[model samples]
Target: MIRPMRLVSIEQILQARKLLEGVTRKTPMEHASDLRSLHGGPVYLKCENLQRTGSFKIRGAYTRIHGLSEEERARGVVAASAGNHAQGVALASSLLGAKSTVFMPERAPLPKLAATKGYGADVHLHGAVLEETLAEAIAFGERTGAVFIHPFDHEDIIAGQGTVGLEILEQVPDVETILVATGGGGLVGGVAAAVKATRPGVRVVGVQAQDAAAYPASLAAGKPIRLKEMHTMADGIAVGEPGKVSYAHVADLVDEVVTVTEESLSRAVLLCLERRKLVVEPAGAAVVAALMQHPGAFTPPIVAILSGGNVDPLLLLQIIQRGMTDGGRYLKLRLRVPDRPGSLVAVLSRVSSMGVNVIDVEHSRISGALAIGEVDISLALETRGPEHCEEVARALQAAGYTVV
Candidate 1:
């Protein structure tokens, strides 16, 4: 339960903005040409992915560390994170001339782990998941007399994140709606407070991965509730529970919260790469996912916050591969053909005739599904898109080849 206290005020946010003037970059708000006419209004993207440490995490991390009393600062700091916050706290503590330790899950991506260590944190790989890692970090903090930098639950963190909201208002003075990617709600809550305080007429919508959403339930219950399960490709925003401090702000100020599927996240990431030439992580692309899945719901003059860009390279490759499949450019099909020698050649010829590139082909006659005189061929092909996939499918079927 959140303790009753005065909420973070505009004065505090403004003060944070002033403090961060030189510490953080005022990230760009680029107009999204592809979405300009959405709802007959212009759309823009708040590109926080390009921020320091490849995420908005640094803003809060820096603020929280900087706010520590001089005596407290002498004791150092400790934090736990899946990736982005680890890097943020590590980098921020380094910048402040403070000793820092970060606990990360054993399964945390290599690039993030390397980057966090690179930023001067004494990194520990301690647990199988973030929650377990977090517990260890807190224990370490208590053991060593170090300050625990709560990732998204502290007032200072919220205040620092609110600076992004201020930047958005200034960058797009006439913006009508702001769509933010939410995890523990730090970024969105801070943004909502700043945006709604100054411009209550503007809509602030929060988007979360459907597989790990907690905000909707928390809001409905009027308190933070821990989810029983959490899973998603967007690991950055996959918090299973909403933060008490941030949740209060989000529940009161955010206009609505929505969720998007894993497929939408991949498509959104692909769209960002293909159209905007920006490399956004799945969590950062949650705003785009919501827009793609629910374009009609938003009024234009909008800005979608691309919250981070710390995606692991392997995950990115997988998302791209999956995105291609989802977009109908890649296909996998299994079919039974006569066991005769010419059968494989015939299928390859038909596929080639339609200008489809065969990525791989496998045939087996020993499968349970195959008849005595027939072999099953599984083909992975690359086509132009949905229309071309259909054309290829029709051509193969027309050639008396059964596509299963």
Candidate 2:
């Protein structure tokens, strides 16, 4: 019987830190000033988004590939990922002077696919989800004599990811809590073991997108459990089933696992973009999302990991609009007004007077909700926020226009 690699040792994690000293970046842990004042305590952000391959995945990927035997390396390696791991393995293989092949889902972001190929790896777009992609990758590895590199689950991978925990301890010795984005549980489980083994007093938390979370259920069941359906904006962490090996460590070492809503994830990403000037992907911002949803839930001297910045540009545009809508900074109003040209001008005048920017305006003369001579007018406006949106709504109402 084949055994799964479990319980990554702190010593292994420490060794990984040494191996990764020059291979992977020692990502900086900086203070979060805005979150600090709100929480009345120190809050730091571990900017792993700035790491090579745009994520912490490279740490493990490099470690795993580096540990392969000379003969094994000669046969090359195959791996699968939604995006982050694909790039990680590709880069790792290239760095180690080994051939690499990466399998990614068809729906994977274009930037990731391009980056994987750019790193000198043969890229194959297959399957619709990670599970299917992973299956194809494993099959190809078997047929081609290439070793299949698991994205997470191996002891080497965990040890490599645990280097982040080591860095946290070294960078912020007084840190009381650490929040990490959870996907396959590689980063979380590995980091948890490293931190708990060294700083027993420090709390390590895992944040997952609620829609696609499997950790909570898996933890409850005392084993890895698969979700029937999973969907979330944080595609980086959207694993239907938690890694068995990673789950073992997580169940034993991780302090708590929390879930963040899609809306919170959107707002967190926007906050990082607007306030911190960081373009954090949804999965990377899951820690921020949790903190936003539950203020004061964690102790001070907290550090949240910004896991990756690999979001598709097209998706980022939609996320920004969703964030604005959720924050009440974007408003859409339907009104029944006279079809006269001056009536449309009057509405625009009121909006301009209120200091609200008009994004779009459309006049519908034949709407079912409108009577004869009454046109259904739709206006999309940008406001300061919820308060401004409310103020503008009242002003429009006061102007004798029926708003629906």
The C-alpha TM-scores of every prediction are 0.94, 0.96
Candidate 1 lDDT tens digits, 1-404: 45655678888899888888777899998888887654577889999999999999999999899999988889999999999999999999998999999999999999999999999999999988788999999999899999999999999999999999999999999999899999999999899889888899999999999999999988888889999999899999999898778888888889999999998999899989989999999999999989888877898789999999998999999999888888888988888888997999989988898889999999888887777999999999999899998888787788788888
In model 1, how large is the Cα lDDT of residue 25?
A: 96
Per-residue error (Å), model 2, residue 152 = 0.9
The TM-score of candidate 1 is: 0.94
Clashing residue pairs, candidate 1?
A: none
Model 2 clash count equals 0
lDDT of 1 at 364: 88
Score candidate 1 by lDDT.
0.91
